[model samples]
Target: MPTDPRLTRLDENRVRVNNPHGIGATLFANKEVPVESGAVTELIEMLALQNTARQFAKAAPGSFDHDPEILRVAVTPDFHKARGIPVGTVLATRGYMVPQAIGNDINCGMRLHTTTLRPDDVTARIDDLETAFRHIFFEGGRDIPMTRGQRHAMFTGGLEKMLSETRRVGEGLWPLVRELGVADQLDRVERRGSLPAGRVFGLSDFMGEEGRLSRDGQIGSIGGGNHFVEIQRVEKVLDGTVAHAWGLKSGTVTVMVHTGSVGIGHLCGGHYRDVVRKLHPQQLKHPDNGIFILPEGDRHRAHAESFWDALHNAANFAYANRMFLAVMAAAGMRQVFGDHVGYDLVYDAPHNFMWKEQIDGEEAILHRKGATPARGFDAMAGTPFAYHGEPVLVPGSMGASSFVMVGQGNNESMASASHGAGRMLSRGESMRGFDDEFRKFMEQFRVVTPTDLRRADVRQRPDILNKKLEQIKQEAPFAYKGIGPVVNTLTEAGIARPVVELVPLMTIKG
Candidate 1:
């Protein structure tokens, strides 16, 4: 079999793939680690997927058939085929925004917290902490201090609006916020723990729609599928200067929460996606009918505003979701240990989302699916941690050590970094028994999961129990690419610099 001529190795850290159909879709991949043949095929498929976006290009920006709406597509080192398109793929476009590139889970991301507690403090009560986590994960991460109206405001605006609404209606989330001092933690959050808030983005299409203010119950929950809350130890500070700025030190305990907007995100993303599909249903023909582009929209009225508000609404909800979850996790730790075992949110960033950003003089929408923004100091000029650059948290697979890196703000990457070690295998293909190897692998750290209790304590059909166990095994460490190479690629590409190395001391998953 001859090699695909379109795929060319540009350099040790770059693989260039020219679009076969001459749509000018090019894929540049990181070659710091082994680039899998399967991933390359998936990347090619992603280019073909853009066929739908290309057609909708109102005025092409460069040389292309439809006036260049689809500008460039770059594959991150952690690239892998996902639900339909490839994850870790950065799709940049001018004049239009493709919804598929951001994914169904809006603002799905990780929130990292630097704790005052020492690793030894958590280790001393590891068993009790595990029990508390079992409750936290399975019990929907505890009750959030939010009301019906506040929940609606949170989705519409974000944590900032939610807090104000809470005050207007009652004493607000300040009780808990002041008690835990989590409100101040917003300084370290991306966008201050909220999306662009207020009526400045305008009202939603379903303005007076009844039951619109729902989802109060889901405010603090961690939606399933690769989502987790891990208590980790800062094993090493890779960059002393950056680490000092980010307040990271050796032996410090940190909690990382990864999740999305829960039901709200899904509803908003789906509703707007369907709206786009219905605009021209026949035009949605492609690998997944997944490529739909929204042009420079009026965030002030009608369908465009609906789409804009809905996307931001979901993003806002996701920000609050991760914030509420982090607070809940900190509370749980305080309960198991003591109030002195405190933690402060270090950084919160979303991977699965899209935003209109200006690259050079051209305005384009950067869609980051399973990728994090790696903006450098210039991009974060006014921020408190601007000196150290953006905190890009890369979570490793279950039982694997994760990383904390600072974005180098490389423009070639569209200021993005890999979300995690790209999945080497899909969930279905990686399913297997939780045999001796699986047990030993997880035993290294205290992992509290519902399956652990369900398998041993509860009685069920053998087939049913086995099925449950297999689902958990699909997320095993072996299912992912080695984190070492992925992080190395980030640094080598000049997209980011590794700062802190964190090893999981305890993990909780749905």
Candidate 2:
């Protein structure tokens, strides 16, 4: 593929895109321009269009003490176009917060768990495990009941609060919580798997009554569009020392979860987007790109506070949501392999969210839409990862290999890394062909969903079966760029280094 003239190769893995309209962006990839050049062009166009929003903020008299500027912009290897902002794009700004940058699914992140169970153990009882996972994750087997106070605590304090409400979880995966010893694994998670929320907006309806165990539909669900729970085996250990420290033994089983705040995040995100739209100056037209900026000043102090609170509230719920999904996965394993199958959390970090950090001696809001933090030794000082770096979970497409990496703290890339193998084809494009490829993939890999293809009832209903097949095609390995090139780019770029490679055993998608 011919490279776009706008993209200038900086190094083997980094490209500088010259945006004529506004601030240019740095693209971290194996090539000067990705094979999917159209996506890169669209991303550049989106970046340039942000200038409209920036200009509006600059022109507002007394709304800001200084002009708001986009401090930095970085694109990850997995960069792809989304509804408004592209996935795998990171933007940093001072004096303003872009709610659209983080998108609807707040704190959509990855969580990895190391287990003592061997690959043989899982393969031996693979069918049984699939049945168990389907029942727990999709069917009515998941019975996590939470009280009103516990719900309040979760939205307010995240995983920390859930640990305190252990006794209240009288049934359903409660045993696995104690067996897994989650409290001891708190430190392994980012920010202790919690973000403080000043208030829980639009969550009162899901709270239920005090002292009563109520099961809500949203908490334990794996949301649609790329979110999944996968069981994998350590295929190779690239960095033996880091691998050993993180408990990743070759051939041992591990569970990788990719999900986020479900309905709650959508509620908060939609609310805030509407709030920003309403807050926009009536005389000025909204940006054609639909990106809105919420400025920081006494004038918008109340809205700013509410924005953070809502963002944190959704983020906290996501942390708890991923935790529960992990536990549910463990519960499935325990049911098939017995209580001897122990598990430990390796790391949990959000790929989509905003962070407050001191940049160039000034406070700035850094938004990572589909990028994960790759803070290095100095940034991770005083933590267990300080000796090495933060754990970066990079999962490939459904059937392909995933990688575990550690941050190098490259500030030029805004200390971030790709969340996954970027999509080379859109969902519609993916579903168009590759019939033989799809069939072969399904035969080789195990994917458990709410509808069992083997069941007579499901097979009889072609509509339901075809819908599921289409969904599967959309996420097939053929749809995404090669994981090899993506991870190699990260290593070559000094962004992050691979620790271990994981091969999928079984996948559960919702």
Candidate 3:
């Protein structure tokens, strides 16, 4: 086991760290340099693999090679090396794609919705806004009413489709939401924020079953884990060009939702793993890696196609999920702010997943895990925002500030950017470390509390709400790194430029 798991820079071109996974990988350094830190238990395995990867990078393509380009890739220090792979690992290949490279959480992503109200206006109404957000968010509840056509449109063409249809009525309760900038996000989203036409069958049977059983009649709903729906007000705008394109301005209120295909992605990943396991049982000798070797021919082809379709379905689900949340936010704002809080869909996108693209003139599948798509300025060639590029939402956990950035087209990065201030500690870590001070910090930001709702449930049963409110207080801003630094780093790296810094007034998490 690693005695010291900290990452340390050894030199300009090399770094050293005790392997996070104590049993895998062969650690190595250039002969001129030296290994500064490593775990004795697995240094042999780690060094050997590193040498093999380096050699593969220097050599031409060969049979059985898993994307030598992945070997040449570089990652930031915040990215921890994994058991069989590494977070931020990049792969460009024609031979075969590794499912684990993209990951189980398909289409996991972020969405940003803008509002006319500035930070001050939101601050003024924080208490009421928080009450409304709580009902719209964590309660797994909805207060807004939708007609049959709106429901159909939400599932079919999403918000834009609904908006176009609703414009004729002009009496739609949440017209102010149309201004929140959702239309602008359509072109920037993958597949124009629509589900791939041919991949519906790839969706998981489990997810289908669950969706059918869910009380909420929506396919694109936010699920558990780090996923959250936040009402934030833009505190600052760093890049005028990008900010204007994203419809963001200082003091503007925004709603950002982070979630993905949810259980569907998990279902897809689990299904593929079972198929792969059945094909090659030997790989199970080291199952922790989520690594599986696919056999040749039709079997491999089927697995790949099904996986691709599942991915597409999840991406679509995420797109719909964000749209649903945005719609809800619009309705809530209209009731509270009257016609003053106009909302617009600034940008919506998934930062995690795999897609086939031409990078540096090479046709390859780009797998982004905890990374956003940053295809430069010209990347969105066929979309409405093609000239402006895509808007990237980098959230900073539950209670921290979130960043709105525009893609920079860094070719070396396979046109990618970081997803957020990537987790410095696991969820369990936070649960264990949370103290009274942290609890107090979270309480300071919490604007809403269901006194009557909690009492009603509590009167019936002592723990009816299961201490959800109390547990939520642990996820304070202090638990996360400063968003300002993470944004500055991304901007410095030319991966993205910050458009807005949004401070959270109310947050909902599951």
Q: Could you say which candidate leads in lDDT?
A: 2
Report how far residue 20 has shifted in candidate 1, in Å. Answer: 2.5
Candidate 2, residue 239: CA error in Å?
Answer: 0.5
- What lDDT does the true structure give each of the candidates? 0.72, 0.87, 0.57
Candidate 3 per-residue lDDT, tens place, 1-510, comes to 122345444433233443442312221222222122222222223323333333333332332334423322434322433444554444444434556555567777887777787677767876677666666655545533444444345434544565555554433334434455555556655666765424354433323332122233344356666677788887888888778766787777788878776665676666766765555433223333335433223435666666666666556656767776777776667667886666666667777777777755666566666677766668778766677666777888677778877787866556676676654544556666557766576456653433323356565764744465444544555444445555665676666777778888776565
Question: Which of 1 and 3 is ahead in lDDT?
Answer: 1
* Preferred candidate (TM-score higher): 2 or 3: 2
Best first by TM-score, ranked: 2, 1, 3
List, residue by residue over 1-510, the lDDT tens digit for candidate 1: 125566776665666766575534333345445555666666666665456555544222321222335566767778877655678888777655667666569999999988888888888898788777666656544644444566567766677777777543323234556666655567777787676534422334323345433334566777777898898989998999999887888999999999997777777777767766665435334335355555553321256555667788888878887877787777778778777766666789999988778865677777889989999988888887678789999999988989999998888788899999878877876765436767787556566667555345444567765665576688888788889888887888788999999999887776
Off by over 4 Å in 2: 22-24, 32-35
Report lDDT (Cα) of residue 413, candidate 1. 83
Model 2 residue 68 lDDT score: 75
Every candidate's CA RMSD: 4.2, 1.6, 6.8
Displacement of the residue 447 alpha carbon in candidate 1, Å: 2.0
Reference-based TM-score of each model: 0.88, 0.97, 0.75
lDDT of 2 by residue, 1-510 (tens): 247788888878888878876575898887533546666666766675457656666566655545777777899999888877888898888778889888789999999998899888889898899999999999988788778898888888888886787764658777778778888888888899877888888878789987787888998899898999999999999999999988998887999999999898999999988998888887788777677888887678889988998998899999989999999998888888888888899999999999998766788889998999999978888777988999999999998999999999988888999999988899999989899999999999999988887799999999999999899889999998889888999998899999999999999999
Q: State the lDDT at 254 in candidate 2.
A: 94
- Identify the runs in model 3 with alpha carbons over 4 angstroms from their true place: 1-88, 138-185, 195-199, 202-220, 281-290, 293-299, 384-388, 447-466
